[model samples]
Target chain A: MLNLIANENMKIYRRMRTWILVILIVAIVLLTGILMKTHEAPPSSNWRTALQAQTTQLQQELTQVQGKHVFMPARATAGMEIQIKKNQYEISHNIAPAQYTAWSFTSTIEQRAIGVLLTVFVAIVAGDIVAGEFSSGTIKLLLTRPQTRARILLSKYVATLIFAVFMMAVTIVASLVIGGVLYGFANASQTYVYMDASGHVQQMGMIPYIFTNYAFNSVSMLMTVTIAFMISTIFRSSAIAIAISILSLFIGNTLVAVLSSYSWDKYILFANTDLSQYVFNGPLISGMTMTFSIIVLVVYFIVMNGLSWFLFKKRDVALT
Target chain B: MADQIAVQIRNLTKRVGNKTIVDGLSFDIPKGEVFGFLGPNGAGKTTTIRMMVGLISISEGQVLVQGIDVEKNFSQAMQHVGCIVENPELYKFLSGYQNLKHMARMSPGTMDARIDEVVKLVGLQNRIHDKVKTYSLGMRQRLGLAQALLHQPSVLILDEPTNGLDPAGIRELRDNLRRLAREEGMAVIVSSHLLSEMELMCDRIAVIAQGKLVSVQTLSDLMSGGERHVITSFEVGDKALALSILNRLFKDHVVDDDNHPHLISLKIDKERIPDAIQALVEGGVRVYGVSAVTKTLEETFLEMTGDGIIA
Candidate 1:
């Protein structure tokens, strides 16, 4: 199994596609730095002044909307209040939101759409994990080796998951380093502050919060990649796997939104994908809990993997 | 009860949908020799090979590679065998050396020395570091052979090994297979429509037509019909007189050549071409050409299969 996984890793690393993905991610990180730098107008060294200005602007906007009926949710008002309080506390303690802080970096990952980039790149590998062999006709050579079908398929799945973990690590490390280099590393040790759904301010260790962000974001990633892998083993064409996997990634979010109005939406794969909902986003469905979603996800993972292995093992790889 | 057989395919069969691709075929290949599978297009040669290599599932029966049942214990059976089905499929994105290295990882005991040996054997020394996408078809075929030989498998299976090879490449491969069989004593099974190449490469040949085994025999028996003679056809007028004269002269060797119904052809000694013409001429049959026919493996294959190469 280790040998097979090693072979798979070599195959993936030697391909231009993998390099392209790595380079693309690095380029995105660099581009984010440039855009952030150029977009920050009248750059201020003192974050206190910046925070005071932001608080005044938000408060002004809030007061103007008070006399007029607005469509904004009550949570938005609560979130704004928490943001103002957090900024005031930072200012009082002479704490500045350094341009390159790890907390800011986490926000960059979410705000600058790095998750989408990471997902697309990792999805490509997951989608191609099995089906690409058939499309390229190389599976014949692979299967002819002294390895069982289940072992080979397991190796591919492991390799893909390994790649996913590597990509996630790269994302966090790259963002923090690049954001630090471009702005200031002073905020690296600052705790991450955020507003939970209940309008409460939550604080956590910087490194732990970044890791938490990674873990939470990866819940959807893990599910999508598993789905992609399942599709890959079932279909011999890599194109179909890639197309459907990517399509479902975007479509899944919309589906969850459309279906969340229903009570049974909790049973859906997408509804369970955002595991961060337990601590961060809050559950989409009323009765859904972190453990409940975890169960749904585990069941899907097992069933999909079981299906892939069974089909791959029993398959008659006739021509392609 | 085991013999010195490298591969034993017992009552093998493959069926897809309503059609039986390979039907109840059985054959054994002895060690230290090259075995050939001769069939036209759509013949079950590739299907059988796929089954043997465990690329495709065996529909019925079993293939034993070095006495290990292929279906029941596939990894063990495959450990003794190395194969390439249809065209040599490889990771074109990787360099030849990397490709070989990757394959070596899968097959245990394929050390650097063994890789170098196979590389030299296939004559791919210089371009081994280049990506496979840059290789010509013949180069890829050689690389494929190098990969198969890396593990020192007891049996090597190739499907249409010389499909896109140049004349020199084909000759080079023939020499390599012969040397491997002689030096390493590995059993080689190759399937091809290239009858002449197969004849030059294999000691024994199995003919398959429409998924059924047609005949299996040594090269000499297949070509010369168990006699040390060449089959020759003489185009002549007075077909009845020529056929009768040839029948009487050559005895059991004389048969109506299905290839040319208008002329009578017979298996005769090459040196006796003049005697045949003289007999035909004296028998009042006008001989147009008294040429000694090339008793090519082509003739034997067509006769055995009873069908043309549709694909």
Candidate 2:
């Protein structure tokens, strides 16, 4: 079994596709960093001046209202006017400086870039792990050796996981290096996350945020890898497996959105895509929790992998 | 025959849909014998070999290799058997030495010395360092043989071992296989559509047709008992008169060609050739040349299979 694993690892490491995937991840992360660094918000001078003038006018009106209420309107129904003035004051004071600065922008960009990169890379690597042997007519030679079919398939699965982890590490390292160089490293350790519903944000210290982000990203990536590998084994054709996996990644979200509008959305695989959405939300989304997503994903993983193993074990290795 | 049987198949039948590829086929190959499996295209030779190597499942029968049931303990049974079904496939990116090294690690008790021995056995010493992709077809075939023999397997099953080799390469392969069987006591089962090659190399041959075993006999037994013929030539004036006289005297004993005169052939018993010659001479027909024609393996194969060469 160890020998079989070593053989599978050699095949993956020697393939040109593996290197191509690694290089593509680094290139994409670097490109994301460059785009973020050169991005500006059209100077924002006009919007700032307009906002200042509005604030001054609102403050002047509040002062006049206060003077009137203090002098003669004490007995006259002044409570309603005073409430209006208080609302105006609250609005003006809340308009402080914008929070979407370079630091916050880089963090959001890195988070999204890493997610997309890991998803795509893991899907591709895992999808071709077993299917490629069938495509290339090597499976016949491999099975004829003194090794069980289950061992052979398991070795391929383990090799794919190793490849996924390697690619994720590459993406993480590249993102951090490029991000720190372009944007100052002063707040490098801080966790800056954007809330999806209200656009509210939070800042946390570096260690806790980085560890949590890594854990979440790793789990998400593993889910995609396992799913793709199962599809590859069930189909035994690299082209079909890869096409279905990538299409699922893009279309699964839409299906979830459509299903969520109806009553049956909870059963779809896409509904669990946001496994970590609860962590960033000030409060978790109603009826959706970390435990729920984890259970749903674990079920999906088990079913896909189980079917793959069954089909692969029973497949007739007919190579013409 | 040796006390140990290298391979045993009993009532083995493989059916794919409506077509039965191997039906009720049973055979036993004794230890240290070079057995030849001969058949035309689509004659279930490859299917039978695959069943022996555990590449395909046996539908209704059992295959035992070296006393172990193939279906029950395939890996353990396969450990004693080495096979090359169809073209030998190797990793194209790796060098010849690297390819052998990888396969050597799978077999128990194999070391670098054994690798070097097989490499030299296949006569690939000069180019074993080159990538397999750069080798010629014949070279690849040789390298495949090296890999098969790396484990020093007791039973070696090879399908079309000399498919794409030149005449010299074929001869070398024949000699090497004979040596393995004779000197090392390795049981070998070789499959090929070339009957003449099998006749030269195998101690025994099994002929198959339409997924059925037609016959299994020694090479001499199949070729020795057939009818013999003798060719007799005559030169004479008035060819028509001579032919008439000869036919009248040796009726039902001669075959005359009108287009080619002075040439008559006789298919008589070997012992009766002298008597027929004396009788023909006394009847006043001039005998020019007389010789016996050797029977070839091709005629015997055609007579047995009722079909011509596939190509």
TM values, all candidates: 0.87, 0.82
lDDT (10s digit) by residue, model 1, range A1-320: 78889998998887888988888787888787778777766536766777999989877766766756555676777677667776776776566654445457656665466887787788899898799888888888788998778888889988988898888877777777787777666655566667664546677767787777677778778777888888888887677888888898888878988987777877889888887777764667766788898999999999998988888988878764
lDDT of 1 by residue, B156-218 (tens): 999888887889988988998898889989999999977888878999999999899999999
Top-lDDT candidate index: 1
Q: Pull out the clashing pairs in model 1.
A: none
Put down candidate 2 lDDT per residue, B185-292, tens digits, no spaces. 899999998987998899998888778888888888777634554445555544566667667666787777667756666656677767766766776656776676
The 10-residue segment of model 2 chain B with minimum total lDDT is: B225-234
Q: Provide DockQ values for all models, in the order shown.
A: 0.75, 0.44
The 10 consecutive residues of candidate 1 chain A with the worst lDDT sum are A93-102
